[model samples]
Target: MKISNRSTSTGRRRTSAAVALGAVLALTATACGDDGSGGGEGAEGSGKGKIVFWDNNGGVRTDIWKEIIADFEKANPDIDVQYVGIASTEYQSKVDTAIQGGGLPDVGGVGAAMLAGFAAQNALEPLDGRLAKSSLNGKLNKDMIESLKAAGGGDDKLYSIPTSANNGVLYYRTDLFKKAGLAEPTTWENFYKAAEKLTDKSKNAFGYTIRGGAGSIAQALDAMYGQSGITSFWDSSGEKTTVNDPKNVAALEKYAGLYKKVTPAADLNNDFTKMVAQWDSGTIGMLNHNLGSYQDHVKALGVDKFRGVPQPTGPGGRRVQVSNPVDGLGLFKSSKNKEAAWKFIEFALSHEVNSRFNESAGQVPANLEAAKDPWIEKAEPTKLAARALSDGSTSIVQLPYYLPDWNTISKADNEPNFQKVLLGKLSAKDFLDKMAEQLNEAQKEWKQQNG
Candidate 1:
């Protein structure tokens, strides 16, 4: 399934080099149909009355999706849903190729990170009109709907519907905190002090774990906002980059300084899996991850050992966290069976089906009613996150999700520079400056192209 708040992987090592190569392939590869024509088999209006649906995380969530598809098909005897599962890492490349080469699926999983890119290519069908007439109109979360619209170039048109959300959390060892006489880390100042006090270098114990590989940018961004007090990723009109703001630079510097003091040197190359494994197996005081890793943490260190809290706050006393990356489903523009596909989408999003899916996936369902499911109510992380979101104590820093080059800049380019910062080879100012420059250029180009 699409893991929230972090990149989905099979606990494999995802180095910067590997990710760069994948980004290169995704960008450089070309296919026919630049004019948005379906030139080959399974092209628009070409499928033989069968609904071909693709699962973004093929092997990871194939069985679960297959079960859902089976239920859909069984309920509608006349329609046959063809299932195809694609790995998360390769899904974007495959979809990009399909958009240009033909043979797009009727409906498929689309990540928040990739939504703008795909929508910009004119590959997705707008679903705002269809959603208004369906049962999902009042059921889906309103904030999430706004998020989808902002991601879709802020045109007030939704190209995809949110399926679930993963919120940022700080998981800490309760026993260790009690032993150290430290209060729960509720603020950045307290968290830093606790990290310092918890570190026992001779015992190989650390205060926190850092993610320097693959998905480092998001974690760093969260830390930056928590310390900086900046609330948005761009200016009012979305024409500037805020990465290099003085406040943000100070935040990044402070965050990077935690390395070699409260964190292990080995953390410089750790991905989420390796970092989570380290925290799970060792005497770590706190770990930064999302709700997606909740199950893994619970499986490793039972419920009594640790507790998950929302990300810490800054001096302003507000918990400033970035919006959790969303997982969504989009309708392809080329699909001829739009009506039947909408039926399937509506069915999957029904209260009961939505509850079942999120319960199995261990994420907060996008359906507002599904959030009240007993399974979610019993889960500590979900409950705490819901409180944080609704209590008005947490401020979500909405990034410019409409930026099509976000994946390339954030993942492929920003990761290696972050690694350099951790290694002391690059200064935080330099890193943010370079990142801001690249993003500014991208923002200008996007305006020129779209306007």
Candidate 2:
């Protein structure tokens, strides 16, 4: 998925706008209290009550959470559920208001990028101790769990468990490649040549496309960083940013080189939406996008017409995918219903619920058992993704607090400067120096406000 700098809107919070489609449970503050009846920390000492849930209204995977809510209510009749779906774009501001007034939901879903920022502000409750005793915790993907732990930082505490996610991979047109006498590229050099050969003026086609937009560049940077085999962006333990290092410079330079050939000059304006349009029009041979695009393309082009492969190797010969378990359900720090919330989490990740969700929604299942799920095995893209996750070819990076601004800087600063290098306006070394300067300044300013 693209790393967006814009705040999450309420509508984007839940990909689906559908209501619970179940009974509307009454809202009562007494429901989520920390009573002795297995209700949790900071909850009121009440025995029986309802749990209020706030979900993203228009996410691509909205129905999964809806179904989970229905199933949870059916299983636990004593617990009442009050559901409110929020749009993603307005979610952060809505949440900010709620947080300031101490009126958060009992349980809610959050984007992975914002998880750390919340934890840092003491807006999230640590789930490590509670989750450790659950039978389902061990069945989650280790890399996903590690990503969450890394995002939490300091104590390796888990603030939330991933429910679903998206990842980036190279989408190629096999038919075009065959006609052009090319194989799916395994390295950057070959990929460039393939793009040139694929680009036919008469055919109105190009080799590949990328989101030159900030979100796209950040995703590309994550992909490039992974291929460079550098694990951490900044070592909080060490207290320094390695963005100015020679290795990073080399990676940036390599990207600048490739930007000259395959990618369109209008990349600065391109985002996932525009890139996908090019792919749909058959005007681009390859593009980088998330799992949703994988499913969407397969549906549009036919299962055998397209395929997803690991991103090509960089100059350093490393492979990586920019992805993480981003969708998750978490209880608010101000929540009163601990038991109700945990019950929702458990039911959401249960074998049956997870499988049903993955089957219809076309996502890689968060539950490990869901990996072997029949829906995954039956679908071409899901099958490929399942194998990729199992083999550890994916890189799920922890987004830092200043992600919004970081995304902007990567685009507003590095992209134009790098584009200058591609257009022969500057040398790679000059581009790298300018990029490092901007990134360093961004890092410094971010620390001042968030750290």
Candidate 3:
């Protein structure tokens, strides 16, 4: 989720390791030829041939990529997929280096956060026309596609095809809620009331855990907008943010106030992992996390003890939540095997294939048919999230992913300020205002450049 910059040496080291460790499908030059099956644009080696792919987020994702690549090759024996696994810390720099020195892979991870940089550098191949003619045209999730398009530097061209989305869930302890004679935490009012009533300082029990450390910004934004019923990230002019609106400031006031009173004191520095640990080990009332940890909670507490649900509704009974960063694949403009690369992308996103990938990744598959696989219906959070997203019960507030500096502003510039807000060292309004200034400036810069 956090793809950061790195030194040239570190990037080269990681890139070499990627090639050496997992380029199993590397094809000989004789395997390269145009077969015209993918109906793509490009030069001679454009069809049923071989293409190299770089996994932008390696380490955790390498094994799954290997499986996907193998399956893709089995389906299309003529198309060979060479997998390069680059750790996330070095991914961006490695790609940048490739762009400068002339070695961009045929395809690679173009996740929403990194899409802007790739598009900005003109490194991505536009896939709008190609996709419309392919089998995947109408089968992909519309929202996920829009998120990718917005991230593609505002050019309205499809550069990356989304594979899956991670949605946030409000996890509540059913056992604790039942014992306390409280209703399900379906609304913000009920959530706060339960949090206050469930705390027992003498016994080391608490109602909630706050992620005041790394990756705090996304959760906070969801809470603010979900409570305020704000659906749009931008205002009417489309050149500014609605994050620091007065209504959101009021919402943040109440959300941040729960830090010390009902949450553990250690929450002042807890990140998602630590916050989830506290929720799993303690008698906390609720946790705001994505589906990635559902298995952990199930293992620790058993399935009957907890349940994952969409975020509680706001005053208007509307469910508005921020979209977790979506991961997608992009074809490089420099790919000599464009048609083959496109076939690999299409093959990977096919119903059964995409299901396999998202199953291992623990995410909601972007392919509509793949989303309906029996496994998603059985997974705790993924089931509810996939259903809600597909049925239109939940509305998503897309972040300004087109802003190239968004990650820096959210993680580096504001994480400390957010912790201050939780610790009472700063007011909620001031914190939101600081974020608003940075966001508005970034928006202006983006519009100027794109226009």
Candidate 4:
């Protein structure tokens, strides 16, 4: 929670990866078959009963989840489904509170970013055995399956079922670009120049908007690495991060400096929604989001006005960006009805249901059959992205999704410091240094515990 343009491209895998996501879809939804208050004794509970399914991205993805719940309940009248929607920004904290105090959902979205953290706490049920017994055994994407395993600490044990790969997309105003005499924003140099030239503060027009508040770290890191062309998350020795390298700091400084200079002052507190709203309501030159926001933009500004493209290439004319996070469904260890929970997951992953969900979100589908839907070909951004990545001219920088602390460090610990850098209260170097320190320590601790 994530595009609408119409075009065709043959490489949907690259496009799916490219046009897939904006926010990492690590939703902490729950689907319990018994009374949620029943608590911790559900390790071997039955599978059919009352289910409380919670969604972290309430306003953004509420409709699709609700539709899915309705379909699931309709198909299995014996199972009762409860729906709860929470804001995306507050989801992580809510999950943390639940993890510590009590109450956890039985089944829901357990994506790559949160897999490590949740698995380390023993909150998720191992799904390898369940998959082996289900009709979905050979119908899933192997790469997505591997990504989940990598996030769960490079093990053979599977904790979550693969959903879809979520990637960052660059949405721009085609009309504005034509008027400004600017080229399509496919390269970093073009991005900077267009940001400067298209901006006219007197008219309240801007080149771009920034996600400075909640969920800011991922976007910033993508920008830093995408521009600096630093492809490794860690150094050559694997003991430290290359996040604080001179090239990266320079990249971040330039990207963040657009906060008020070319972007709006409201950006200081703007999340994805607000930033997208600004882009839609006003004359925005470009916006960095995913397929999740595509429908909104289309309704607000019309499909002809804007175009969704893959993230811009670095200075060296090579496409470089952070890899997309894969999202999925997981069964919680606290569920009283494991069998019932697995049923719901299987129902949702059925070809039609999964395809509808991704089509609505403007993302790539994880189900092999769903991915083959005709809707994917008509998706402009997804197709364009496929062409960008599948053409052998791209280099994706893989973020450390395997680390248990990856989500916490990227969101809670570093988001505030990242904002400080935008406000001129901290240097880009200091922010990166702090993030590097956290990542290095997390890797070290993981090695000590795992080894």
Candidate 5:
């Protein structure tokens, strides 16, 4: 369920490597078409007559995507569907190379985090008009559709169609909460109290598991917004970063202080996988992760032992949580077989097919009807997420998705600085200041280049 491009634990090891890759990507930006035009010379019009589709997460969703492709081909006997599954870790790099080298796929999976970058390069074919004429226009989730539009630079144009959405949830042990005479962690006040009460250093038990390694920034940002009540990653005008705002700094300090006392020392180096494994096998009280890890928790601890709930609300009695990175499919402008490729996308997003895919992936489907499947109805996490979204008290803190350098800043550059905050080597203010400095520079540069 993890999109390799968004999650750090997927194999992004060194910051130096990421910096090097960022440099290469920056240099190749012009190669991806800077004038909002289609791709390279030969990239125009998919003349091959074959639909070359790329599945972002090769091994994880290869079989399911292949099955969907098979169904699409069965429905259209004349169109040859070429399926190429690439691991999440390698997908972005490959796509960047293709955009520069003139071998882009006709259609491929694109996550919210990567949408702006691709759109900035003009590699994506705008889908708003196409979707309006398609059957999926009104059947898709409105929030996700809006989220995708925002991710594509807040334009009316749609660069991608949402396939599914993920959200942050706190999974807690029912038995442990009962034993401690504690209620569910619904508010930050109660959540922190529960963590403190559940931790027993002598017993090698902690309250929470911290993901200080790869992909830690997003979790930290969620905690900050949850406590600080901030609604957006950037301030009004989208030019200034509010990461180092006083309230955010206070919220971040409180979140990071839970490290040694409530979280284990080993958590300092733990990625999402390691953190989840520790929480599942050990005596942790609360684990914060996205819905993608729900199946893993169910497998490790029976469904009866634990429960997943939306993020705890802030002091204002409002739930301020950042939306987990939404994944979707984007059409390549260079493809000659655009119409045929659109047909396959339409087929894959049909209610039944979307239901089958989301069911296997254990995520909330983007198709409104597909979300009503029996599997989602029976899943507690999905039910809670649905309620949270519909309750009218939750606010999503949308990040600055329009910035092409967003992925680099949030993933690679911000991680080590966050780790410093956890290790107490850097203050929360300093961390946020550094992050804000980088983001502001990136934002300014993006405007100069893009506008």
Candidate 6:
């Protein structure tokens, strides 16, 4: 759901505005009637009507959809899909309002983290039977499907299928590395040394850039926790809060260390755009990020500016990758075009469409068949990402939605403590203890709300 690598020059507020303008334009141009579904509650004059699909896959991936639309229309002359692209930031709140106001889309986008929240509210229709009957049953990446099922709950009833699979990795300026005689950092200790050596104080250069904006510092924290094998709150079962675990404390220590040596003084307010800009300008030597914005970098600085490496291993001997599966579609329970929506979903997941999307968008496809495509092997970032996904040792953090109290636990309680800890304003022990206490409170409240 999160697009990585935004340009540093475009401020967040401006970037958000631009995306919103695009969304408004797309919505106005595409869906202009009494809803795309063509009727009320249970009206049944269907087969050749329209289905609204709200998503943010508007860049290169949108073009792929245009091509797919041609093919799908040719195959099923009856169904017309009105595609509306919404910016990712506005997606959750906007969709929630629409759903509650009784104006939901027939089929809507669901990112890995958003799926479980929506499903928990019964906003999504189960697709277990539909997937089995369609040609797409065997075409998707098994791991991605399993992840979706996990996000949707253990019932094996899927609400979304990832359009792509992604894992965060280390991207560094190869030229900078060579100048400093530094190879990729295999361990946390080595990474620190490299950061110290590469930082040129005279040129205002730092070892690595980071995202420290309000809404994004947690992401940087996620990368640190991931690289250090720290659990945010609950353990793997999603049962109990444990953000204060000793391992988590260790992760915070590592983060504080990173802030001390590698990061720039201005990094406390930096975002992805700023970090990538610093990197491109040769001011920073390294960064930890997702590949979503790789294309933008290629456009701004050219293809030769960067290369990918695995995330550095922590003290625990684990190299975890902070990841979120690609956004995909899910049917709404109140759809008049349920069958037609399923048909389109089936079409979208087919090998032909999957290949087209991956090829054009530069995204690693979620289809098992598409992963074997020659293009994937040829792309450096894609190749490294694919290798990590297929690596059996890799572990996934639960999507934000899977943890019901994620909002309160992450934003309200832990985030402030995390900031204070990182700034050395709060001792790591105090921060962790407070985080644990807050998470336990949230878990108790959530149980009461949902039980």
- Each candidate: what lDDT? 0.78, 0.61, 0.79, 0.78, 0.79, 0.63
Q: Which candidate achieves the best TM-score against the true structure?
A: 4
Model 2 residue runs over 4 Å out of place are 1-57, 74-98, 101-103, 133-137, 226-240, 250-267, 315-317, 320-326, 359-363, 379-451
Which candidate model has the greater TM-score, 1 or 3?
1
Per-residue lDDT tens digits for candidate 4, residues 154-259, read 5657998887766789999999999989999889889989999999999999999989988788888889888988888888888788889999999999999999
Q: After superposition, how far is residue 317 of candidate 6 from its true place, in Å?
A: 4.4
Q: Give candidate 4's whole-model lDDT.
A: 0.78
Q: Which digits, one per residue and each the tens of the lDDT, describe model 5 over residues 1-451?
A: 1122443322323332343344345434322212223333224433225678899878768888888888877878777777889876567768766665556778899988878767765677899999989988899998888888888854557898999988898999998999999988999998999999999999998888888886788899999989999888788988888889899999999999999989999988787778889999999999998887787788899998899999999967999998787888998876666777788788878899999888777789998999888899777888889889888989988777766667767876678778898989999999888788878876776566557
Model 1 Cα lDDT, one tens digit per residue, 67-122: 88899888887778888898765687778667655667778898777887677666
TM-score per model over all chains: 0.84, 0.72, 0.79, 0.91, 0.83, 0.78
RMSD (Cα, Å) for all candidates, in order, is: 7.0, 8.4, 7.5, 9.0, 6.1, 7.9
Q: In model 5, state the lDDT of residue 244.
A: 90
- For candidate 2, give the lDDT: 0.61
Q: How accurate is candidate 6 locally (lDDT)?
A: 0.63
lDDT of 3 by residue, 1-451 (tens): 1134322223423443233122121111112123212222234364766688899768657888898888888888888787889975467767765655455678888888778766765667788998999999999999889989988878898899999888899999999999999999888889999899999988888888888887789999999999998899999999889999999999999999999899899998887768888899988889998876787688789999999988988867878899788889998766668788888899889999899888876688999998878888778688778777778767889888887667667766788889999988999999998888878877876777678
In terms of lDDT, the poorest run of 10 residues in model 2 is 19-28
For candidate 3, the TM-score is 0.79
How well does candidate 5 match the true structure in TM-score terms? 0.83
Model 4 spans with C-alpha error above 4 angstroms: 1-32, 43-46
Off by over 4 Å in 5: 1-50, 76-90, 201-203, 236-238, 446-451
Q: How many clashes (backbone N, Cα, C below 3 Å) per candidate?
A: 1, 38, 1, 10, 3, 3
